[model samples]
Target chain A: MPMWEESSLVRVVPSARPRKLAKVPFVELADGRLQGVVSSGSDISRVYVSSVAAGDFAFACRTNNNRPCGGLRGGFCNHVTALVGEAVLQYGGARVARYLQAETAEAADAAGTAAVPTAQQLTAAMSAVRPQQSADGQAVTGQVFSRFLRHLAYLELPATTAPLPEMHWFPTAGAVA
Target chain B: MRADLLAAELPDLDEALAAVDAFDEVLAGGLLRPQPAQAAGLNALADAVAGSPIAALVAEAAEKAAAGVAGEEHLVALAAGRTALFGAVHDAVLARVDEATGRPREAAPPFEPGAPLPVNLLASARAWLCDVARAGWRGMDHELAATAAPVVSALLPSAELRRLAVLLDGFAAELAASCPGRTLEQIPLRRWADLWARGMLLTQPGAIAAAGAAAESAAGAASTALTGRLLPLGVDLHEHATGVQAQVHAVFEPADGGPARLVRASVSAPKPDTVVGAGAWQLLRPHLSLLAAAGEGRAMELTGMPVTDEGDLLWSDDRAHVGESADVFTTARVALPAVRSGATAPLDRHPTRIAEPVLVEGYTVDGSGAEVAFVIGGERLAVDTGRVPAASPLTPQAVAGSRACVGLLRWDAGRFRLQPLAVQSAAKSKAAVAQAGAWAGGTSDKNAAKAEKAATDAVTVLRERAGRLLRS
Candidate 1:
């Protein structure tokens, strides 16, 4: 028997509440960008595919038809905000913060007391200091939407205990290897 | 289709079993090639059951299955196809195919002349288990032997059932050996009893249906919103012949003045070598942040959590958020007094289950700490150290006059014993009040440096053992 190390035991700290992200259905950290698909609020038929580069905060939000979002003027739009929030919800706030290179220092609240910054707060802190940047997210938008559509397809599957050929990679408990 | 009509259409048991084996072999091969689409065995099976209602669906399913893996989102497509296929076969074909006793079912006689008709074997197994839990295995050795007699006698004797009987007999002998003052073997007696119980349950007439129902309930059942303070007790790792299982034990005190429940999150790896190199804690890094919060004894909120029948929390799609940190000292002081004395009773909900979680507080360590017993209200409960091979024995110096301890109460060596997971101690000075996290030396991060060194030492021991083996 060996004693466990202190680093392995992580002590958690309180952070801010996550922003609502129901508009965004898919979010992922991949290809050096935080990218996802966000459905349009007003137009039920439309969706916004968005991306933000890891280090530079370079962002893009365009519809599936290559139409650019009007909310990308000086900073991140609501779609991008929803994307980051959902990304935080899916991955931990710490992991998402690290991926986006967002600073995680404790920010002072209105009462002048120290408060632990969440992923959203960290991202906001980074955006406040850096100059606005943009990127062409046209190529990755199609890939993200395609993946989202595939995710939706899982719902169509009928309920059964039979082993799926593709699910062989995911082991179930009590399964005989 | 009607049962009589379907039975007429069905192939003999041998043919059906052969077909199923062939299909299973193909599945086991996974994505590998060399086998052709639409295997001959599958076609033959379809032809043999052509008169059945689902023969066409079976053929279609077989063809789609034989086709090689698909593009992105292959899992969804494959699942839909497999579900439809299995549903058709199960409802129409396999339902009538009696693989166990075969068609024209054997008229096996009852073990006793006046044995209960349509015997509830599962209920019998459950009652027997409840008795064994109340009394130690040795106390119930006679009942354990007698319980197996009828199930074996009533069932049509097959090689499989005979082997099960032999297994039950072996367990009885082992339990009898665990008499007072006897050196007990390391074998997990409770687990063996659990296995025997499940085997006995399956020997009944409606066993398959009962099993299916149990599985369905386990998969779908979720508890309502659970708000509580969770204290991370410790982590335990065990290496089995097939793989490794690591568990995180904790005590969850519900906010609404409900009884405390022991929460356990376990991760298993069928292939150990792939995950074991980095150490068990590293393997569980994904849950590290949450566990670390609980390690400090944090107030948390959980929703739609799926708990095992035995009450250990299962980590599947459940999400928990850490809130304000709780003072572990005050919490333990308040919580310890609420727990009732004696071994934690077995849950009647799950009959064939083992693993009863318990927390024992305010126990003074007896003299000669090398082999220790917790003296609680004049009752001596020995600490079972065999389960935690890596943990150091509880020394008087470690406790430092604090009596708070939490662990699982289990039957071991002909009696019940406490396997301590976490312990607490008080500070010598009043200026610095002993924080729960600091006193959690039993499982706290303060032991990290020592843990790393121990891991290195373990590797060296393994190398030396290997060298000795080679020399031999």
Candidate 2:
């Protein structure tokens, strides 16, 4: 799967203000993406999606409120992660991988001669970078996957989709076709 | 007697007697007629006298006229002369009384002691003592010693008593010489004591003492009250007054609440600026000393020409500017000379570059009192001191602004900081631009741009000069 397509799901709180709540709807995206809003208080909330199938992803979020509040965690919530993951599984990660690789290559070029690795090459490098464990040791793939997900979140990416733009989702096979 | 001559003389005699009665009435009434009318009346009387028998009887009428008694001219002259003589005596007595005590001499109840000494009197005594001390009168006689002792006792109960007493003794001895062969009743001990006190108050010791006490007490009370309400901020309060172009008293009080015991100060001067009266030095002295002890920096004393009436130039002639209507006064700018004491590292030795004299300007409104303004270079520095009386010592704060330039040049090296002292308008900011321009050798411009340019240039020059001095 493409690194960008490898989505994770995490819970979030929703904001309290009427305008903020209106901006974050409870219904799925117009294109059939799964999404839900969560909040710790009326003033603060996080719109998110969570699923066992998808790994966890979260970002700090902010409102127009002048008071100090949390920011969008990696610009995505669990709901967006779930939506992306579902889309990725149905469509396959090849196109998304290509897109992510192109963006990273462009960034590398801008930074002046850092090696621009392909998506497959980057995945291979990640696998190598993971610490080796004993054969009888506990399965460390979950930890490795979590660390990789965090590193991908940290990576600055060019905006592929405009924020709060209309979203579309398709069934896995149909989308791939 | 010839019948015709006798008849003519009789009528003249009657006229003369009538004139005498009129003169007696005028004198008895004690009415002060206008000068011109009085002169005219005397002239008319004198003309009648010249035509009378008295002139005819006198062989040497010209001689009598010269003596101012025989003819009409003589009578007129005598009247004017007598009037002048009486006026002079009155004026002299009034002036003398004002000098002896701190009140108006002509006012009722002259020399009323036991009442609180006028603030100006205390300030003057303090200034006089300082001058005497500076003059090395430490070993002066009883009169001098007496002059400073009581005044010092009044102000500084704990410190410098012995020195002050010696000065007062010398002053008292001098007084003894003035009252030759007179018994104590003729000039009572109380009167003598008051005179001695007045002298000391005019000097440095008395001013220092009164200012020290007033500043210490007031500052203590204020600090105590303020500390409870606000953050524990240390404040030094000073006060002073002036009269007739002399410093009466100046006082300074340091923070008494903290480990720093309040440093009390006072001083007096004959020609203190209107603000921070002559007595201000007494109030300010202790603070200067305290600041010096704290290793704040060195003080610089800078003398400047007072502003003149025509607004033409600054001159050192003290008499030139008085009574002339002008917006600026020639202020004696005292900048505490730079001292190197409290710095962690050795500073670069800088040549002492004297700063340009600062101009203190302000206007006097009839009911509102004197409002003085001070300008240092181009900027209008805040004047934190009180009103300026004719006679008083300048306060350290009054002098602090000009001293700021000195401070900038001389790094505060734990010695004493030079601060600007001024006798200027209380409205420090508004008229400062004009003052600065005047100081920088430019006529006050009505145009904003020109005035601003002049101010900028003056400031730049001052800063550059200060910096160069510091570097050197």
Candidate 3:
């Protein structure tokens, strides 16, 4: 039990949800990238694994089998956009912006009130950066999908208020958000 | 050598927290079950810190737990001590950490602090009258006279604020005829005296440091903008002899990260009879949408908002724009601060706690209604329902069933109590989070159906009253 500092409330400008999370699940900020599995619109059985690197905004989107998404034309595909939106939901806009180092100078209004980038702006900013697809798309896809499957395992536990031994590291104090 | 010994002998902060966490595991399961290991850990910690400030109290509690006294009273006392000890230790650890990090502590203000008073004196007079009446007019007259007489006498000569002082005296005199007793602490006498002092202080410019500075700087500071997730908790309606006031209780999450601020918007009306508990929301509906986003929190973009030093947001309707409504349970569970357990002695003496109070979450209610204690972070904090508004849906039954709650945490009646303003039964439930009562003014979808009839009845009565007043 390390003595935590006198905790201060963290202020957040909650990101606007421009897209529903059903399109993208298993979104995470990990391994220096925003990566997740996204559902294919036309084919329910098909799924796309997408990722966008933090800096330089380099991105890659491919089917779990490493087939390049038809929508990827040197810029973000729909799957990448959905990944960013879901990431905003999981980790707030301020955090996502900080992670990606996204430009916020243009976010200010005429009166100069500070505003957080909308999902559309953040996605568009990612698009402006010259698209650099990762070479190991299949390996990244396998990693994220396995993580998603691992999360689903949590639902199996019988519900109880008692603290689980495995989840003890989770901060018991005020929420960081 | 003694200094070295004392430093080495000090109780370890991490061990204390770990011990409390372990104790919470046992207490949450019900105190009747024995856990020898947990008791031994506490007893060892107590033994380890013999001369520390809390050693005796901790040792006493550990003794009771080790004895396996299965009595309800023993359990209750253990629960109280557990909550108090956690807070005290947590604060002490933070203070030590701050010292180690060389963080500058807040400098104490030079002047003796006075009770914070609202700007409006007329409302204060009416509220004081209400409190006196509610307390069966007991021994309040002498206390009222003793507090008010000097303030009124001081202000009588000032022609500008004389009427306000006179109004305060009238309320005091009205109660002096009956209700005689020697008990000074029966009602919130300090609250009554706060308004009196406020009136007297207003007559002299710059008498009170914070209030005076706020008044002088308000013009230049009005244009500051704040953008954040605004969670409207519930509405608190104050009914006095002269009128009714509905204060929309809300918290503002800043765009960056630091501390959340308590933002409040108030609407007052002269018609006290027509505007009651749940009905007051109707009057405020036109000015603020905070009520609409009560249980389910909202993201807000605002410009030109004013804030007090105490972190109270001054509501300016025209300057604010409401954005998306967030998941109520997630917002309540993650965004709100955790309740810190400790002796509320510092808070008890003050007329008003100057620190901005953001609502607390992650608490499960134990006990029923006003008698309830919030079991949170492994400690049980009791609820003092005396100040909770009648329109709030946080009833006795509501307390028991709620899985999560969002409410203002206050120090009252010798302990910290969570006055739940909003409650969520389950995550992603259709209603999301339901407001504790009818105070939302049909804003919360959960209570919208219930508040509809009450608001409608209030409106019809208002229309009839207007017709008669105009005709006469």
Best by TM-score: 3
Model 3 alpha-carbon miss at residue B187, Å: 6.8
Error of 2 at B54 (Å): 62
Model 3 regions more than 4 Å off: A1-177, B1-229, B233-237, B241-243, B248-262, B337-364, B368-370, B376-378, B385-388, B426-432, B437-439, B443-472
For residue B16, model 3's alpha carbon misses the true position, in angstroms, by 29
- In the order shown, what is each candidate's alpha-carbon RMSD? 24.8, 41.5, 28.2
Candidate 3: tens digits of C-alpha lDDT, residues B1-472: 0111112223655565444444443432222334676576546545544555656665776676566553333333343344344445535543432332232333222444433434444344433433332232233434553344444444333333433444454334333322233332232222232222333323233222332334335537643445555655565544332233455556567666545645555544332222344554555555555555553356566555555433345455665777787554555455544322112222112312212223444666677544667665666655433334444555555555666665554332122344555666644554445555344545444664465565565455334333332233
Order of the predicted models by DockQ, top scorer first: 1, 3, 2
The DockQ scores of all candidates, in the order shown, are: 0.01, 0.00, 0.01
Clashing pairs in 3: B87-B341, B392-B436, B392-B437, B393-B436, B393-B437, B394-B436
Residue B298, candidate 3: alpha-carbon lDDT = 61
Q: Write the per-residue lDDT of candidate 1 for residues B1-472, one digit (tens) a residue.
A: 1112222444453454344334333332332231563355345545544666656655664454455432212222222222333333333232332321122222222222211224454345334433333243324333344454344333212222322232333333333323221222233332333333333333333332222233345556644334566655554444321123445555567767787655555543322121122233333434334444544556556554444433345454345666677644454455533432111112111211123334456567775665567777666666644344222333334443446655544332223445555556544542222222221123543554465444444334333322332223
Q: Weakest 10 consecutive residues, lDDT, candidate 3 chain B?
A: B1-10
TM-score of 1: 0.34
Relative to the true structure, how large is the alpha-carbon lDDT of every model? 0.42, 0.24, 0.46
lDDT of 1: 0.42
Clashing pairs for predicted structure model 1, backbone only: A1-B390, A3-B451, A4-B448, A5-B448, A6-B448
